[model samples]
Target: MRIDCPHCGLRSNEEFTIKGEVPKARPDAEAGQDAYVDYVYIDKNTRGRNVEHWHHSGGCRAWLVVERNTITHEIYSVIDVQEAQ
Candidate 1:
């Protein structure tokens, strides 16, 4: 698979690091221990399209948010972490 890093242009997936899915919002302090445990330990393991955190470690070394398919591995878009915010 290839990822088109905004700063580094097209590159192999080996150049990047996959950090799993972007997490849901953190539970408030009062939300309880179970909520926090689920947030930290559980993997949603979404099967279709999802947003993920990727680091262009071998290239520009920038953090990026990648929108892609989990099953098909089709990358729809890549954006810098700063720009994603």
Candidate 2:
């Protein structure tokens, strides 16, 4: 697998680090038990094209937006998360 890093250019996927999903805002700490439950267990382990956060640990140390097909282990795109939006 390969990923294109904005700072370091194209490189092997091994050069990056998986940082899990780029989550939305978290519920308030004082919102109670449900908030804690959701925070700990809510995650979308999607099988098709999905957006995930990754870091180029072995390259430029920049965070990347990885568009991957989880089931086939095929990566469609890799771009800097900051520049993606």
Candidate 3:
């Protein structure tokens, strides 16, 4: 698979580091047990559209935010992390 890094253009998947799903929330150390566990260990693993973080380590070394389909692997959008946040 190829991921198009905005800074580096089209490149093989090997050029980027997949940083898993985008975090929706983080629990405080003092939060409830279940909440903390859910935040740290659980993955809702949504079946459709999902956002991911990717780093172009082999190319421009820029962080990218990617909107992709979980089941189809179709990338709908790619943006720099700077712009995403």
Candidate 4:
């Protein structure tokens, strides 16, 4: 697998570290323990297209947003996390 880091050009997947799926929103601090527990421990693990956080640890060391097919491992797009916002 390969990832096209916007700042470092194309690189091997080994250069990156998977940081898991991006959360829709973070739970509020006052939302209580159950809410926090669910947010921290639960895994949605949905199949199909998913957006994830990847760190270019072996390259530019930048955080990226990777949009890819979970089942096929087909990367649709890779962009710097800041640019993604």
Candidate 5:
């Protein structure tokens, strides 16, 4: 599959690395161990229309927000992270 990077044009998926789901929250220094463990090691494993970050390692080296369908491997949208905000 190809990911269309705004800075580099359409590129193969290999050029990018999956950076996992977006970090919703960071455990505070005073947070309990279970909270920290969940933050560090858990994966939501959601299906369909998942939001994620991808790094374009082979081209402009920019980050992008990818809206993809996990079950079908179909990407719905690709936006530069900065522009996305």
Candidate 6:
């Protein structure tokens, strides 16, 4: 697998670290058990396209939002989260 890093360009997936899915929003602690469960386990495991959090461990050490195709394990885009917004 390969991912194109905004700073470091395209590189082997081994150079990056999977940091799990990006949460849509922060959960409120007061929301209790249901909220905690959703926050911890509810994620769209879509096969085609998805946004995931990844760290370029072997490059710039920046967090990136990667657009990937899970089925083929191909990365389409990678942008630094800091600059994305």
Best by TM-score: 1
lDDT of all the models against the reference?
Answer: 0.94, 0.82, 0.87, 0.90, 0.88, 0.84
For each candidate, give its TM-score against the true structure: 0.95, 0.77, 0.84, 0.87, 0.82, 0.82
Best to worst by TM-score, what's the order?
1, 4, 3, 5, 6, 2
Candidate 5 lDDT tens digits, 1-85: 8998988888899999999776668988999999988998997978987989999987888989998988887988899999987
lDDT of 2 at 49: 81
User: Worst ten-residue run, lDDT, model 3?
Assistant: 20-29
Looking at model 1, residue 26 earns an lDDT score of 92
lDDT of 1 at 20: 88
Report how far residue 84 has shifted in candidate 3, in Å. Answer: 1.3
Find the 10 residues in a row with the least total lDDT in model 1.
41-50
- Lowest lDDT 10-residue stretch of candidate 6: 20-29
**lDDT at residue 18 of model 6 (Cα atoms):** 92
Cα RMSD for predicted model 6: 1.8
Q: Which parts of model 2 are misplaced by more than 4 Å? A: 28-31
How well is each residue in 1-85 modelled by candidate 6, as lDDT tens digits? 8888888887898999998777768677788998888878888667688888999998889999988888888777788998767
Q: State the TM-score for model 2.
A: 0.77
Task: Assess candidate 1 and give its lDDT.
Answer: 0.94
lDDT of 4: 0.90
Candidate 1: residue 51 Cα off by (Å): 0.7
Q: Residues 1-85, candidate 4: write the lDDT tens digits.
A: 8899999998999999999988767788799998988888887887999999999999889999999999998999999999988
Q: Report the candidate with higher lDDT, 1 versus 3.
A: 1
